[model samples]
Target: MRPLKSLVAASVLLSGCNGMPVAFTQDPVYDQAFVVHSGGPLPYMLMGTAVQWNEEYAVTVKHIPYVPGSVYQGQGDIQFFRHKANGVPLWRGYTPGEAVTAVGYNSLYMSVKGSGHALPAMVRLDAKEGNVLYGTHDGPVAKGMSGGPVFAADGKVVGITVAFLSSSELAALKRPDLASQSRVSIFLPYAEINREWGRYLAQAQPVTAAPTHLASR
Candidate 1:
């Protein structure tokens, strides 16, 4: 079994005055994800990534840090207006060994020249539990990637990244063989996200096109 303290939740937050300007992707499928931030002084700093679940609702990992009494107070509150999301994607379950892309707003990556806020991470699904999905990717899991969406092969969002087990954590857990390997990202399955935010999610109705107006012919 893994050590209880193995998981590290991404908590690096950046505000506009202290970090890069907010960025976004042109692809609508990946654009559904957005950065979270505080409203005051550092209004543009990225707090974390969140996926648009509907016209009025978005889903993010529960571990993201938030300022007290603000719109992003914490898990207790369901309102998030610090930053805006571009679009919404469909959801589905994941299968082992399935190829997926995790889209997140990495703090360090965004600050670098030309890097967009929404990063697409290619990872292979490894396991699933009651509340989380486990996956392995080639590179390091950077801070601020938390709350990003894990998209399945069909472009559907399957999970929301929450944490990752670092190589050191593997050593602590007595898995020396895997200690030298890359980090294992942890995500909250889409189903669980729905359950966690059911009250608010249920309130957002699917958007419908406005009726076309035609002059009487």
Candidate 2:
């Protein structure tokens, strides 16, 4: 997720935020959740977006503040437990030039209390590096949309919004042709996300040490 320029007070409420563009709209499905970081008692900062996978679990990108398999205390008393990173088989069913939706909340585009802005996008490419897959979309992804989901045409989640390629990143990747584009967003395909989920789960597991000394009877 893109970092905030400055941290606001925990008490600062979201006010006077801009609305979504005319081309974009709101959807209840992706409005399942919005993640935040505790600024303090008075104010908290909006981090990114998440989608409810089920009543008990939700899916989001790995960059948010909350850890996988942890409790996500939402606005008020509403709470949801972050889904654990799993070895669930990777999903690679998306096709190029397919219609998709990128949904998430941005401080710049606040619509409702608990919902995210939805942008119509097209699948530009889906590239595989090693065992990980990254999907590229021609969506105008903003700062707060980082952890949002990219929904396929049939309303199935295909990828998690990660970052948009910067000019330098494109250069490094040897993609000079994309330089003219205003913005091209990148997403972690479910496969790459699965890979990271497992990594995060492993990291979060506590280390169990062998007994330093045996108990003497």
Candidate 3:
């Protein structure tokens, strides 16, 4: 996600003064979800742009007295949890160890076939306990599978199924050492999207109107 420099600057200006809570007289807006998908069975990660900022707040009173905006690009994986609806999330952590492929519109694809180099597999996890969910045997990813939704048992769209890993990468799996450590494909976390929801909304929101007194002065 891209960061908001304007908001960061505004926060800095507001920080200089302290007293009442400042209201963002304007409404908040956000952008559409952006994602990247992997080609095969490995997990996919989510990425987006955002604005980072520093704020000053009173220790006694839980309030933000100042805010600054600096724009930056942020990325993370889509994690799955049970308590929610669709597996899609607004924010989450980054999982670098997981191999990911780039798909259009911030979505990722992974595989599950054990024999194939990088096979795509759905990430089945216990929502309540956060345990790995698995099936009886490895499954093959079909052509039409790409872009299809990967859901938890609760029917949450945790990720989109992409492609498989290349033959060379698959070949590496033949080694007992590699097979133990690596999987054919990866699953993208849904939580990654939830984390940037605020900034995305802010970017889309209409800029607030300057106060009448300030405008006249």
RMSD of each: 11.1, 9.8, 21.1
**Could you arrange the candidates by TM-score from highest to lowest?**
1, 2, 3
lDDT of 1 at 110: 60
Lowest-sum lDDT 10-residue window in model 2: 3-12
Q: Write the per-residue lDDT of candidate 1 for residues 181-213, one digit (tens) a residue.
A: 554555656555565555443444545656566
Model 3 reaches what TM-score against the true structure? 0.28
Candidate 2 local lDDT, residue 60:
60
lDDT score, candidate 1: 0.50
Error of 2 at 153 (Å): 2.3
Q: Candidate 2, TM-score vs. the true structure?
A: 0.56
Single out the weakest 10-residue window by summed lDDT for candidate 3.
Answer: 57-66
User: Candidate 3, residues 1-217: lDDT per residue as tens digits?
Assistant: 2122232223222322111112222212111122222212333322221111112110000011111121222232222211212322222232333322212121122222111122223333223323432211122333223222333323233333333332343343353433442333333334433333343446658589999999999
Model 2, residue 201: displacement in angstroms? 7.6
Candidate 3 runs further than 4 Å off: 1-139, 170-183, 196-199, 206-217
Model 3's alpha-carbon lDDT is: 0.27
Q: How close is candidate 1 to the true structure, as a TM-score?
A: 0.57
Q: Could you give candidate 2's per-residue lDDT for residues 1-217 as a string of tens digits?
A: 2222111111112322222212245554555435544223323444666655445466664435444454443221122345533322123446767776666667655522212322233332223223344566665555666656777756677776656654544554556555665556666666555555455456658567667675342
